[model samples]
Target: MNPGKRYLFAGLTVLLAGCTQPAADSPPSGIEAVYTDFFKEADTDRSGTLEAGEIGASIDRDFAGLDLTHDGVVTIDDIYSKEQAEPPGSTRNPDLSSHLPYDTDSDGRLTAAEHRAHLLKLIGEMDIDGDGLISFTEYRVTRRF
Candidate 1:
């Protein structure tokens, strides 16, 4: 109710707003790093390629775990639905659900094959000039402020 208190609240609000991270739907600032991590984790055979089967089981499990309705498939909306349904203070990380926007197909589910394709497509888009690879400059420019 006091002017000084109001100004203090406003300043605190501004600082808090600036400290918040970008929404998950926004383009990530580490697209290249994401690619690297995905490649490393999913390339089970060390062959520099992501075989469909390598990620298949995990994909199936992710769908089964999130498909609370038992509909045999999971949708982007379902991820948020479950998030909201979670009990308070549960330790689940929501970052993985950020992959939704890149799901090209509207099937509301992503298979291992789809995940591989999506990552490749994302790399291509970020390449800008079709260089077939991401340079540090391109990576920084694509993901930087």
Candidate 2:
């Protein structure tokens, strides 16, 4: 082989080898992957932490939809009513099961405070080191499985 051709082939081989290696920050499969992917998409500011405002729009929309009586609050009744009204397996219906866990006061309703607390708790879990920030490494290590 010509000297120039040999050098070009070697360069190409090196590039291919580098491409095959996994990224240092690549998230693993399962739960970690889900959180990592969500964090990446939700961190609109790219500040690494998913702040309240970053998710405020989604939260507001969901809350509004679930607060059937326009009482500025969501109760189990509202969820139950919505569930009953919707046909089985309807995609339009929101899964109310997740909200049940956030009823810390046990008043049978989910207030804004409870909603905020639930979100904060999730953020705390993701920030395993309690550094008030969730880096990719923290997210990876915090996976339950």
Candidate 3:
């Protein structure tokens, strides 16, 4: 190979190597390392998505914490009201936008169907190859995580 070509190849190799190195705080390399415990905890029925019954316990706790009026249900109104009520820089405030995707009907309420659909959608996005399964490389490349 020509000397110029060799130098160019070496430069490109060094740059690529630096780019591939994981950050210090990066999660371990593999879907299992990152999601095994979470999947086990959330996938109560062993189904990929967390269904209504499976989500009840965790959702109930989150709902109770966010229900400012102590109402039995959590509505979009409650989230907005809480956001407006919280002072700037308050860590107590929740990012209500995260819940919007689950309100599929846009009725301002999160139903089990919506929740399940949302989770399935996330899984679909993570399955980059459309193989119905997420690999470590797919998870790492997924920007949503």
Q: Number of the top candidate by lDDT?
A: 2
Q: Order of candidates by lDDT, top first?
A: 2, 3, 1
The TM-score obtained by model 3 is 0.43
60-128 per-residue lDDT for model 1 (tens digits): 554577666676555655576776576788765444345465455645575545655665565566576
Please write out the lDDT profile of model 3 over residues 1-145, one tens digit for every residue. Answer: 9999999999999999988956757655465455645545655666555444654554455556666567554566677776656567766424444656567566666554555566567766877887665554565467434
Evaluated against the true structure, the overall lDDT of model 1 is 0.59
Estimate TM-scores for all models.
Answer: 0.34, 0.50, 0.43
Cα-based lDDT at residue 132, candidate 1: 58
State residue 63's C-alpha deviation in candidate 1, in Å: 12
Candidate 3 local lDDT, residue 118: 67
Clashes of 2: 0
How much does each candidate deviate from the true structure in C-alpha RMSD? Answer: 12.1, 8.8, 6.9
C-alpha local distance difference test of each model: 0.59, 0.69, 0.60
Candidate 2 lDDT over 46-142, as tens digits, reads: 8876556766654565567778888877876687777657566765424344647787767677887777677667667876767666676666566
